[model samples]
Target chain A: MAMDEAGGAPGAAKKFLYVNRKAPYGTIYALESLEVVLIGAAFEQDVQLAFLDDGVYQIVKNQSTDAIGAKNFSPTYKALGDYEVTKLYVEAEALEERGLTADDLMEITFEDEDDDWAEKPSINIVSRADMAKIMSEQDVILSF
Target chain B: MATLHTVNKSPFERSSFISALNHTVPGDKVLMIEDGVISARKGNTFADLVSSALSDCSVYVLAPDLAARGIAEGDLVEGVQTIDYGGFVDLVAECDRTQSWL
Candidate 1:
């Protein structure tokens, strides 16, 4: 693996898809997985975050971790844009099955560098089939 | 070009370890971490399953996790190696990709 001057991967960026299929709070997987994403952002890989199955609840708006005595990291999703980790794919079927829609999710966006810092929605509502195709195309898939 | 499969759950508690083992191919590597280190202990009930998989793939257990769980180095399965976090990072970089069986 070649490293650039900043000690980052120098070759072609690998496509990394983080598959989140588990619900948050109930387990540490979701939080720890997010930590990996944050750390991996420095690697300059082509990163895509996918929320499927019960994972859809992770981004639900108005999450109050107060009752659970856990530090709420929901706001971290909003800051992903600063790390250039903006692709957030939500599975359509997952939401429908859980009686949720895109409306229930927290609005996540990134500033478009090419568009004069115009804000663009980060969440891409995709069908399960399309998400599967995306998964197949990824060079690296990190599931949690 | 093989995948580094990470199993973080204990075999006695969950099926993540077995699922990871089942999905691993010949050249793939399995790294047992956290509670997954329990499966790597010598003389365990799952020793046969792990030993069988060792014939096809390499198995590793996180040293710190093993220590935390009071599993001595000598107690690890015959072919299983103990690696530090740096070794874990190297394994991830060496493999084509990684799959966290959480």
Candidate 2:
């Protein structure tokens, strides 16, 4: 097999990127997945998160859980930046459908440039086509 | 690319999943989770379609999901990899991308 600049296979070092498409709190899966990603960051692995479709609800600004008695967890996503998980992305179109803009989000910061998350990070997001390429390049992938 | 497609609902009840599978290229990995693992139970109709479409792909079920629903690995369609939470992490770590069909 041909080797790449990293001395591994062409795409061996990239960290795991998770695609979360479900509404948060509706099911335990999304929350659990986020927890796992947070743990991955502790190991210094690169982790990127993308919210599309109903998943955009997780990032919606000012979500009130008082009606449902659910302990407001939406704010926790904002704290992901504190974990150094800066590759936060939402589908350009999903945002429109949900009538959300960056203004409507909770300031979950992103890296200055696209791939600036880490020097040897294993996680990040790409466009849909690039997502496919990254998927092909990844050593592992998971969805929850 | 050995993509892992995790479906979380029944195939008939949740068409988004089948549609998601339609986008998958052959040899992709397909794992069932949450309510989606039910589709792989033996004698189920959805199992037939999944078996036909991604014959070359590896099929798997989350052990907790199957057990909670009163289904067993032995009750699943032949060849599905019944895995635990750690295995689930390994599965995510092994695939390049994951499309969750809700």
Candidate 3:
């Protein structure tokens, strides 16, 4: 297909979305994917980052990563704003079922997790259907 | 709108990959990486289902996985692309969204 002047599909802006569902540090794949997304953002692309399933662990609060000799990098997720990368989506049910709430999570505001995903918020919860909808609208996506 | 689905495990081992494939639209690409490459072998259900669902969408297997498994490239079914890390990156760049089925 044809990319428009904005580097998106014909005639409009493009959205680059990344999905992460794996636990933290289980493998380097998720981390590598995150780095790629960050690089993509550097190119001045619209980026949205989402976490689901086990991937929720990457943003959990009070992680004892020091025991594993890994730096507490979960905190860096909040720093994504420094790059002007504000789109952050999380699966609401994933956190609720896992006994986690925004208060229990690292200090962050989440969008509502609805399947419609109509309102595009900087940070919010998204239902699976909405996630799929957002994915369909994007010009590029990276999943880990 | 290209939807790239990444499957990282064998088919029988996990229905999540199959579920993901079932939900995929025509013209969407599927890349089998890590142990997921094993499903590309002929006679596997995943190999058959993918071919039937998408004739145009590209299917690929990671080169390292095939090399480590000692499976010759020529042994795989027709139309499956074998790519390295860079080609994989290209897929990431080209698609609109990617989902990992593990």
Candidate 4:
């Protein structure tokens, strides 16, 4: 669905969008989807992550699951950049509705090897309309 | 004649919250946890619905989830109550049956 406008090149890297909506630790979706992304990173596809609704909590800083007795995998998110999955789209309305700001989230960065190996933030906060447009442009959408 | 219903999804995102509310008998309890706590926040689009549900069943929001979502006690719908995991366990023991609105 993403590369259709690009003449459907058979060997071209397909754009894969991971849509995250549920809150982390509340269900298996968030962690499961993260695992999928890490596993699929081997394919070298163009991957973009979209976090909206309660999914924004997935990246929120200082999450302690000790009381809940669940594994805290939030740290794994920071490692995503190492896999070359650098783009992250977070919905602004979702953060505002939840009384959160980008400052509340963990810092994730990737190095721009092409540009003198400069480190850059990976999270890109977007409006709902912008998020919709980004989703429409993806070749594949994976909902979590 | 009482059942404790647990709703873990946001009412705005999933119909399960409303469906559980609709299926509740009088004297039932509806406890909001995880993303479901968002519906209990004051001035939300579903605030009126939650206020109405309080008349039919006791509505409670999990305290931890509220804190996680940055919802303070003062920000809850007028009639909503907040509870912690211990209270959650108490509700389960007090009720004859437990239903999960997934």
Reported per model, the fraction of native interface contacts reproduced equals 0.50, 0.37, 0.47, 0.00
- In angstroms, give how far residue A103 of model 1 lies from its true place: 0.4
Candidate that beats the other on lDDT, 2 or 4, i.e. the better one: 4
Worst 10 residues of 2 chain A by lDDT: A118-127
Top-scoring candidate (TM-score): 3
Q: Given candidate 3, what's the lDDT at residue A39? A: 73
Model 1 / residue B53 / CA error / Å: 24
Residue lDDT tens for model 4, A39-136: 99999989999888788999999999999999999999999999999999998988998899999999999998889989999999998767755654
Model 3 Cα lDDT, one tens digit per residue, A1-144: 234544734545466777777778877756776678667766776778877766777877888876788666776676676666777787776677688776666765333346353333355777665665566666666767
Deviation in Å, model 1, residue A23 alpha carbon: 1.3
Q: What is the TM-score of chain A alone in each candidate?
A: 0.92, 0.71, 0.76, 0.95
CAPRI tier of model 1: acceptable
Q: What is the alpha-carbon lDDT of model 1 when measured against the actual structure?
A: 0.86
Candidate 3, number of clashes? 9
Model 4 bad stretches (over 4 Å): A5-7, B1-102
Instruction: Name the regions of candidate 2 deviating beyond 4 angstroms.
Output: A1-14, A96-103, A110-130, B15-19, B22-102
Judge the docking of candidate 2 as incorrect, acceptable, medium or high: acceptable
Q: Is the docking of candidate 4 incorrect, acceptable, medium or high quality?
A: incorrect
**Residue A45, model 2: Cα distance from true site in angstroms:** 0.9
- Candidate 3: the clashing residue pairs are A110-A124, A111-A123, A111-A124, A111-A125, A112-A125, A113-A125, A140-B95, A140-B96, A141-B96
**Cα lDDT for residue A88, candidate 1:** 96
DockQ of each: 0.24, 0.25, 0.35, 0.02
In model 1, where do residues sit more than 4 Å from their true spots? A1-10, B1-102
lDDT digits (tens) for residues A16-81 of candidate 1: 899887788998878987999999999998899988777888899999989889988888999999
